[model samples]
Target: MEWHQPPAALVRTMNVVLRGVLPSPLGRGVGEFMLLAFTGRRTGQRYRVPVTAHRVAGDLCALTPAGWRLNFRGGADVDVTLAGRTTPMRGVLVEDRAEVARIYLDRMTELGMRRAARMIGLKFPLGRLPALDEVAELARREHFGVVRLSVRT
Candidate 1:
């Protein structure tokens, strides 16, 4: 399916809602939610966006079909609010297709075999999951952007 950006107003609303709840005790149980704060490329102003983050190999990763990843073309300092705690982190854009595929597959696997497969545009036998190599190929072909964030100790 073709990806369409959500309306800006809706995105802003989401950010507001997520920010209000994510730091609360109730929001602490939402494992996948996080607040990613970074500077806008052109405006040089700070912007925070809510994302569904996946932990991979001790790093936080987010897959966005949106252009926000462009702000970290090389790497950017960021603050991530996760589970009611905010920490300093370095956000790196993973441009290598192979690495992107690996991360994507890892996240999908975490999300659930069947759901992840379907989200990645894969159709397989009802009970079977695609191999990692297949997922990598599909991810490379589709050009998904992966933003990997490492905590700055």
Candidate 2:
């Protein structure tokens, strides 16, 4: 399924709202969002990006298809700020389409299909669970995946 981007103004507005709330005392109220701070590998530039994340198993995973995710291609150190606390973590990008599809399906199953679809830009008929093959095709076409973030030990 093809995805559509929200209006640029709406995107900007959400960025503003997320930037304010995701680091505040009420951060967790918004659910599944955090601020990720990382330095670029080649340019050494710093970046703070807001991402939707869900805890899977014992780690936080952020689904993304943005270019900035390349920074974690091989795994990189990062600082995750959530609910007014900052912690160092390692982020590894999982770009394999099949694996990404599995994780996405698992999350949808866990989070409820409608809610997950709204958050992840997925579209499908109501009450019908999408097959893994369908999801894998979407992942392949979209180049979308998750970044698995774990506390640095």
Candidate 3:
């Protein structure tokens, strides 16, 4: 699968919009997005970004193919802001492709096809989740995996 490289301007615009919107009262209505604030293990610089929140077996998780997700590779503490509230949490990156795909499938079904498609940046019909094989194939090809977060307090 080809990686989707959105234009730099578009990415900057989205970052600005998400930062503004996700912290506002209006954010409560957008349950799918959360602001994750973590210090870069290497840079010692704080980074914050909006990510789609996925629920896997009652726990909050996020699947990403981005290099930034590597900051959680060895399990890191993060501040997750969801629905206009911030909480400390531990984020662990799970790289097992099959497991990630299974969680992705579950999340897709749980979130419904439309929302899942929007999060995945794909367009598909609204009734059914992506097939397991299809999801696994994409997950493998795209290096997609999950970062499951546990609340700290």
Candidate 4:
């Protein structure tokens, strides 16, 4: 899917809410942005899921692991909410390993997933997930997938 830039006003609001309220008032961890809400393809109901965001060639991109396939795969017309505003988004499934890794690694490193997981009483599956070289292979063997959201301007 093509990428769409978020409006300047929305970015400003996100900086304030994400940096201000989310961390202090809500006591949430930092480096977290993008809350995606979509109508389940099967259920036709709303479901909201939080994701880490990154700037990929000037457009915001959300990364997802194979674990999220249950919620993201085949989903369409996703609604992305940042700060307090909601925007219409088109969901496109992505399966390229290098591309997926580029964004996934960026998110994990930025968010310090290993450390954050510890804080949240979760364990990191050190190397259990597919290795970089085997990403594409694993994706094909299993059902690895991601849904990229392109917000409509």
Candidate 2 per-residue C-alpha lDDT over 29-118 given as tens digits, one digit per residue, 9 for 90 to 100: 766678999999999999888887787777788887678888999999999988778889999998677888899888777877677776
Q: Give one digit per residue, the lDDT tens place, for model 3 in 1-153.
A: 123446789978988898888888988887889999999999999999888887778889877888888999989999998998888999999968889888877777776766666675544543456688988987888878789999975
Instruction: Name the regions of candidate 3 deviating beyond 4 angstroms.
Output: 1-8, 124-129
Model 2 pairs in collision? none
Between prediction 1 and prediction 2, the one with superior lDDT is 2
- TM-score for candidate 3, residues paired by index: 0.84
Full-model lDDT, candidate 3: 0.81
TM-score of each: 0.74, 0.89, 0.84, 0.51
Q: What does candidate 4's lDDT look like per residue over 1-153, in tens digits?
A: 011234669756765555444324352334446666677666777765655555555565664443544555554677766544557887776656667655443444445645434321223455333345554443345443456777665
Which parts of model 2 are misplaced by more than 4 Å?
Answer: 1-4, 125-127
| TM-score rank order | 2, 3, 1, 4
User: Number of clashing residue pairs in every model?
Assistant: 0, 0, 0, 0
lDDT of 4: 0.52
Question: What are the lDDT figures for the candidates, one per model?
Answer: 0.74, 0.81, 0.81, 0.52
For candidate 1, lDDT tens digit of each residue in 115-148?
5543433445445555678767666555678898
Q: Give the TM-score of candidate 2.
A: 0.89
Segments in model 1 whose C-alpha atoms lie over 4 Å from true places: 1-13, 114-128, 131-142
TM-score for candidate 4:
0.51
**Model 1: how large is the Cα RMSD against the reference?**
3.8
